[model samples]
Target: MAGGARASSSSARREVAFRRATEADAYELARRMFLSGERVDMQALATELGISRATLHRWVQTREALLDRVLGDLADEYFTRARRAATGAPDDVIVAVAEGVARATIASGAISGFVRREPELALRLMLRDDASVRRVLVGRLRGVLQDVLPDEAEGLEGFAAATVQLGLLLVWPTLVAGDEPSGERVAEICRALLAGARAGELSGGR
Candidate 1:
């Protein structure tokens, strides 16, 4: 009965795997595929989930929308981790978090792989007005700035925007030229901006 027992165990394993794939929602499956450096193909995803293409389309609308969700979720996770890991004065904390996120993004194989594979689509999705990924990241930074620099409340939005822009600039070389991105430079530039803002140089002596 040893052969019978082996067959039963194998069947159980397949059942468990099938159950996991069926249980995961569309977004979760998409995110898992994205993080695995696989191209998130809606048809393949639907087939794996045992769902119809119509159902998948109704759930995510478009591939771009699904990718936006995946990227936004990753950005939120990275930002949260960076914020938790950062320690220092308020300004320093902000800089650390920004740099940490930048470094993590640069090092992410999934992110870099996607960018290299589809530069135009990646740029369009990330830089579009109302892009949810950028909004999520900027919102997180804005919340932190509001907490740490309440006195500069009037300029915090602008400051947070500038910080995100700087991060994009720092990562651009890697995304475009296959060169390494510099988190240290990001921190240095952010520090300078913070110093200028604190000195009332950025907002005309606020």
Candidate 2:
């Protein structure tokens, strides 16, 4: 029993380390891109981390999976910054949530760029059932919205999902086609969406 427990604990530690390493490598790659305005290479990242290409390949499984894992870890900071920037009235949570959505759209631009350059990566990040990006986002949003919008919480899931779609759409021109977008445009759209929800025009999941 003692041996088994020790083995399990060791395995758990290794798993944790591997996940952290993946995140680190992914983040460094993103930082390089953010700093130098360059591109990211997964295989090169694996080589830098002293891991077999296949090992890193298995860890990420897909290009966007690796990138998403990197960006997914930034949710906390994103939420806070968005909440601070939010404007408008109505319990504050309304603007707070809208700001969160808008901020997410901006922050995700790089990751979306990866997807735009490689549709395969986008599919991995979004279309898969076990996609870590979506899973992390939904879980984070659920936690934040749970108490703040309890009366409207039941629909938060769909609302969050809608936010994701709208974010992509808002960024599509830039992300998919290298076109720029204004925050005012993004905020305007989000305002309309929130108005719909608050006014009970968007129904069905209620």
Show where candidate 1 strays beyond 4 Å: 1-24, 199-206
TM-score of structure candidate 1: 0.83
* TM-score list, all predictions: 0.83, 0.61
Report the Cα RMSD per candidate: 6.9, 9.8
lDDT for predicted candidate 1 compared with the true structure: 0.76
**Candidate 2 lDDT by residue in tens digits, 40-156:** 576666654557778777766765555666545554456656666655454355446555655565555455556556755655555455655455555655555675667776654
Candidate 2 local lDDT, residue 64:
59
- Clashing pairs in model 1, backbone N/Cα/C closer than 3 A: none
TM-score top scorer:
1
Runs of candidate 2 with Cα error greater than 4 angstroms are 1-38, 84-92, 100-135, 155-157, 203-206
Local distance difference test scores for all models = 0.76, 0.55
Clashing residue pairs in candidate 2, if any?
none
